[model samples]
Structures are given as C-alpha cells and as structure tokens.
Target: MRINLRGLNRTKKTLADGTVKIFWYAWKGGPPLSGQPGEPEFIASYNAAVARKVITPAGVLLSILQGFQASSDWDDLADRTRRDYVKLIKVIEKDFGDMPLSALADQRARGEFMEWRDKRAKSSRRQADYGWQVLARILSWAQGRGLIARNPCEKGGRLYRGTRADNVWTDDDEASFLARAPAHLHLPLLIGLWTGQRQGDILALTWMQYDGAHIRLRQSKTGRRVVIKVGAPLKAALDPVRQKEGQILLNSDGAAWTPDGFRSSWRKACAASGVVGVTFNDLRGTAVTRLALSGCEVPEIATITGHSMRDVNAILDAHYLHRDQRLGDSAITKLENRTKSPN
Candidate 1:
C-alpha cells in the first residue's frame, strides 16, 4: 500500500492476513531501521519480501550506477569531466554498491549517507559538498528513469562557496623561493611565473610542445588550445636544464611525475622558502598581474593565460592586479610635470 507519511509519499504492504507491513521506500523489503539498509534487519526483510513474491527482483544499486555510466549522457561529457565525476561516484559505490537503489528515496537513508561522507572527509566543506553533488546527479538520473521515487538531495544546502582568490607571488617572493629551492624545482617555477599556465598543463608539456619560438598544447582542464610565445626568461631557464625525457617535468628516474609526487615536491619547496598561504597555482595569477602591470590589454592577457576575457578582467579587478607605490609615483609625476610644462 502507498500512503503519505510526514508530508512524504511512503510505501508499505498489507499482508493477506490484514497485517500492515511498513515496506522500505524501494518496495523490496520491510521498512529500514532509520532507513539504514546496512543493518541486518533491512536485509532479512528484503529477502522475505522477495521470497513471498510481494516485490519485484530489481537489481542492486551498483547495476544502476554501471548502466548510468554506459549511457549516452556519460559519453557526451568531456574526458576530464567524466574522470572527475567517476572518481567521486566510485567512493559512493564503496559504501553502498550492494544496497537497493530504492533506499535512496528514503530521507533517513540519504541523510545518513551525506553525514557519513562529510564526517569521513573531516568536515572539508569543498570535498563533502562536491561529492554530495555528484551523488545528487546520480540519484536524479535514477529518479528520471522511475527507479527511485524521488531525488533526496533536492533540499541539500551549500556547504562551501570558496573562491580561487589567492596571493600572487611578488618579485621578492620569487627570488627568495628560488634561492632556497632544489635544482629540480627551478624549471617548474620559471615555467609557472613566465607562461602563467596551470600546474597540470605545465607538467604535461613535452619537447614536442616547444617549437623554438612558441609552445603549443591543448589545456587539459578547459580543453582550450594555447600557443604561448617563448619569453626570454622562460627560454633561459629551459636552455640549461631541459630534460630529454618525454614530458617536460620528470623525476630523477626520467619518469613522468605523478600528481601526488609533484604536490609533495612543491610542498617541500614551499616549506624551504617559508612561504605561507600561497601555492604553485598562484603563479598563474602572478603572470596575469605581471601582464596587467606591463600595460597588456585584457585580450592579450587571455591569449597568454588561456583564460577568457571575462576571467582575465575579473582576476585583474578582484585579485591580482594592484597599484604599487611606483604606479602612484608615476601618476603624481605625470600630472606635476604636465602642469609645470603646460603647452
């Protein structure tokens, strides 16, 4: 029997003997304890319900998740986007892969899952919120196919609204960092500060990307094609230490650097320089600021950074670009000189 409970549409069963059994939202078993199917009671009720032929033998949650990944919608996503989504979805599977998909419609079950996920992440708002969103998308897909009664995450609130704003490295910061950095870090630092490309893009670069005058590659994050002119500082840094290995950034064994390896090295270097609250990614913003300070227009900055015009302007206005004492002095001198030599 289907009944409305606590303003929610719930499912239950009326036995042949006129006894009412509160079935779980999935209709596969008796109502779950606090909507937790991991408990033995939920499993026993499900088995009994199936044996009596009172509920259909629908497959577990894993089957639905696999089918969703095989759908045309999944294929339409960008490669990077699909990879990121699957990373989060895989974590969800580790916890609830064997459970019935119908349990997802129950408010208590959904709440428990979110609570467990956030707690495991140590209350990291970004990881918890993004992972929850991935879960919400999967459940929404199931609901659309009539598998679940409804999406439980529709009421989930925001946990993190963090921005990318960070401190850009000044010339003094760069000099201090380089003086203390190991030999392996110098090339990456020069690339970051001069080209303003992302860390991932810089690490992925190969000898084929360099054509004597310019570097050519497609950005992995945004998939935008970028061709940056090789500036003097970058060229100078590479001419002395350019590796023969395939990727531009390689470990001592001439192997391509993994993401974790690069991060560890970067952290150690940061500690060596005693810089705080700044990361290698901040170099991209510093490059934008350098361009803006040199009187480069918004579009020109976008060409170098692979960011759109809107993003370049926002970075200049919100984060990186700033007027130093030199700019202030320039403004004052130009006005004063103009007044004294008024033509």
Candidate 2:
C-alpha cells in the first residue's frame, strides 16, 4: 500500500558520515511532520501542521496587526510611507499589542487610544499625530478584513495644529549654509531650492534624470512625473560635475546617499552653518515663494513643482506666499510703476 499527501514536502540530506536521512514537512517553511511514511503519527503531525494556530493569539490586537501586515494593502503602500508607518507600528505593538480585539468594539477604546496619543503629544505633537494616523489605518484595515467588529480609531482627529506658513528658507540661510557646509552639500541645497523637490526625490536623482537644460522625475510618494527647466543657479552647480551615470548628489566619498545618511550629514551641516529655524523641506515652499515673487502665477508654479492647482493655491494663499514680505514689496513696486506710466 502507498500513501500520498497534498502539500507534503520531502528532503533528503547526506550526512558527513555518508548516511542519508529523509525529512518531511507539511509544506515549504511549514512545521516538520514526524514519524515514517504511512504511519499514524506522521499523518497526525501533517494534519496539525496544516491546521497550525495563528502565531499570535487570535483574540489579541497583535494577531490582527500581523494579518494586516501580510495583506496586499500593506504591500501597496509607498516605500517612504511604509518606513514612516513601521516606526508607529512598533510603538503601537509595544503599548497595545496585548489589548483584546473585542475592546475595540466598545466606544471606550477610542478614549484609551486618545489617552495614549495625548501622552505622546507632550513630547512631540507632530509625531503623536502621525502615530495616531498609522494606528487608525491599521485598525481600519483590520475592520475591513472582518478581523475586528469595529475600528476604535475612527473619527480620531489630529493633535498637531502647527503650520509651516512661515517656514520658508531665506536667502541668508542659503548663503550661510553654502559658505559653511562642504562643497558636496551645495548641489543638494541648490536642487532643493531651484526644483522644489522633496529630499527623497533629490537624493534618488540620477544623472539620467537631467539633460543640462531640464530635469525629469516621478515623485516617489505621489507618482506624478514632472519636467522642470533647469534654473540658472542649479544649472551652474550641475554643469561642472555632470555625469552620464550615477546619482547627481553624492557624499564626500563619491557614493550615493541613503536617506538616513543624508539627513545626518545635513543636520551637521545646518548646525555648523548657524542656519537655524529652517529645514531642507522648507526649501520646497521657498521655491514656490520665489516663483510667486518673480510674478509667476499659481498654474506656472504648479507645472514646475508638480503640485496640483489646489496645492499650489493653498501654499500661496494660506502658507508661504502670504507671510513673505518680498511679495508685499513686489506689489508696491508694481503699483508705483503703474501710477508713473502715462495714460
């Protein structure tokens, strides 16, 4: 009599002593099936392996989180977003991993989650809000999968109310940073200011994306492709080191930069230059401000920065442009010129 099992994996290994041993498992990467072929113990082990319980207790939050992580929704998140979410996920697991999944069904769980967020907010409100968002997303995913009766994170409002309206980098900051920072750091600064790109996109920029006159790239987070005419300053910076291959910006060692590595170097440079109260990210809004000050309309700015009309208008109306004194100066100058002109 012969026996056949579905999803049974068998392997034969030759020992150093010239003996051969056979191994059996329920499936690839699954639990081992003990005993010999056609034996009751072997069949029983195989069945148990096939019906292996969830790694984390099914009633716990950790179990649903683990399931969410294995789903296609997690796989579909942008790389940068996933990196940010992973940090929050770790915090959630540490604090609430053992909480009962059923507790989420009760409205009281929302208060508990908000209390946890409140504690985190005391240290950094922005981080607390980000963590709360990630928790909400995870709970929503679990609920959609029928792993939970309800998502307690629903309707959880943001805790951070800070704005970047006046956060644009100034010309003095740029000049000081350039004068103090290393030569290798200069081009990245120029690229961020002139192109209005995120640090991630700028760091990932390769020579192939540039053509002396223009730069072409697809934003990592939004997946929007943009073609920008090279500004005079950025062109001047890029011309001398133009390469047919590899990244446009490199470290002192002439190698590509990882995000963490670039951020660390940038922080050191910023501190050394006395350029305080402004960040590299502020350069994006600064670029928009510069374009507006130069008399470019919202649509023109959108075309260059890959911002939608609404985003460009929002940045101009509610953020950087409104706070910039240069725009006021430009408006007065234009009015003076208009009055001076003969009718």
Candidate 3:
C-alpha cells in the first residue's frame, strides 16, 4: 500500500532564459511545466500536486479523485468539507489505488468496502461512517461523469448509528476538566461550552465576529448562520483578555490556532483532566443540556445551537432532560385535587 513515486518527482530544467523550471513528465518525452515555474512557491505546490497524483492503473480510484479534483463541484464545496473529502479520498487511494473501476461493478464490492471501513481507525465508528459517506460522494460524482454505470458505494451502510451515543459532559465533568486544564485553554473551553459551536468554528473565531453583545458566524459544516448572545460566562471569559483585536482565539504562540495545534492542546488538557470518555465535542451537547435544564424550549435551543428542532428535541429527550420526579409529582397532585371531593 505504501508505494513510493519519488522517482516520479519533478526535476529542475534550464529554460530558454537563465531561470530554471521544475516539472514532472505526464508519462511522456519531456518534463513539462504544470504551473507558473516562475513563482517563488512553485516547488512546494508542485510537490503537493505530486503527492495527490496516482499512477497508471486499470482506471484506478486515483483517476476518479483526479476527476473530482478538477471538477467545479469540488470548488463549490466549503473548504472544511473539501478537506474532509480529500482526507478520506487519500485513505481509499492508499488501499485501492491500483484496483480497477470494473472490479467495483460487482455489488459485493460495497460490502467489502464496509468491512474495510469497520476495521479502520479503531475506537471511532463516527470517523469510519464519515469515510463511507465521502466514498459514496466520489462514486456518485464518477457516475455523473459517465466514468461508472452505478455507484458501488450506494450499497454501503454507515458504521455509526445513534447520534446521542457520544458522552455529554456533566457539571462534574466540566469541573474536573477546568480544574486541570491549563490557563491558555480556558478561553476555548468556555467558548465551546457557551456558544455550542464545533471545534472548527471555535478555532476559526475572530474578534470581528464578536460584537460586545453576541458572536455571529456561519457554521462551516451546516452552513447555518448562528448569532449567539454573549452570556455572562462567555463575557467574563473574554473581558480579561486584553489582546482584544484580530483573532479572538490564539495558540500559545499568540498566532491563530491551526486545527491540529488546537487538538493537540485539547488532548493534553483532557488527559490531565482525568475525564475519560469525554470529548470537546461533547461540550456542545452539554450546552444543549444546560439550556434544556434552564427551561429553554426546543425551538429556542435550535435557534441558538443551529441544530434542527428534531435534533434539539432528541438531545433533550435522550441525553439532557432527565425527566424530573417533581413534574410527575405535580401531575398526580393536580389529578387528586381535581377529583369530585368524594361527593
């Protein structure tokens, strides 16, 4: 699976002018330039392109990836979504790059793919489900392009089921995490809990997105615009940080946090916190719990959380709203009081 194409890397060639051009052959006579060889960052970009390419096959999965890469539809996808697709595509390419598309015509191919997915990235069924979803998209796009007759991935089933299966952080879990979490991580923790936003959105937060009153942005995954009121907790957390310009959040270096950098920091915090099975994502659902406990209706929670009313109700019913015994007691009390006084 770990095929090396280092020899296929671009070689530097002297141009008609004194400058040099870096390029790889497309399997032909000359090292043809693929882009602006004059650009300063050409080598870095050229190497990236090389890493994304695959060799000749009986119509390899790489060819479909290549086609998708060149399609306008790829450009239309949100950047975060595109990154996710590319990441999963590379995983599939690593395994099945040499396999022919004709092999996929067999219906059993879909089941085999699911088998492979189930075994991958152990401990996270959600990630495996996501990979299958992306694979289906690529297959669908290929079908649209007439590259294949039917999408083999259409028969594949998801690996993860119930959305509420993830751990929702409790008050005790929050206290445990904050007690051990280093000071630098406090802002992100507060933001995650208070705004009920995803990790991607938390990392991407800018000062411009926050007025003194609320935080507003279009969510990357759902494309929903959410304007969350700056409650007391979030306000107190933000007030003390005097660097109140540009990006609202920053890494230890005071630069904006990259996704990997933030994850690494969060992992360290979680490990030190001693809260097993709890995740940063769980904090968002925890916020939903907090809202429900405060008597916010499902519609009110959806407006703030950017989830559907159905999803909000599901969360409240399954995870957040522990049905109070007092409510049942009150109902029984009302029934008894309304009885005909034994007359």
| Highest-lDDT candidate | 2
lDDT of 1 by residue, 191-242 (tens): 8988898887788788767866788877756667888998998898776766
Worst 10 contiguous positions by lDDT, candidate 2: 11-20
Of the candidates shown, which would achieve the greatest TM-score relative to the real structure?
2
Q: In model 3, where do residues sit more than 4 Å from their true spots?
A: 1-59, 76-84, 118-128, 160-166, 242-244, 318-343
RMSD of 3: 8.8
Please give, for residues 94-137, the per-residue lDDT of candidate 2 as tens digits: 89988999889888899999999999999999999888888898
Report residue 254 deviation for candidate 1 (angstroms): 3.0
Candidate 3's displacement at residue 106, Å, is 3.5
lDDT of each: 0.71, 0.82, 0.72
Give TM-scores for every candidate, taking all chains together and pairing residue i with residue i.
0.66, 0.79, 0.74
Query: Can you list the residue pairs that collide in candidate 1?
Result: none
- For model 3, residues 132-155, the per-residue Cα lDDT tens digits are 888888889899879988787786
Better of 1 and 2 by lDDT: 2
Off by over 4 Å in 2: 1-55, 334-343
Q: Provide the global lDDT of candidate 1 against the true structure.
A: 0.71
Cα RMSD to the true fold for all candidates: 14.5, 10.9, 8.8
- Candidate 3 lDDT: 0.72
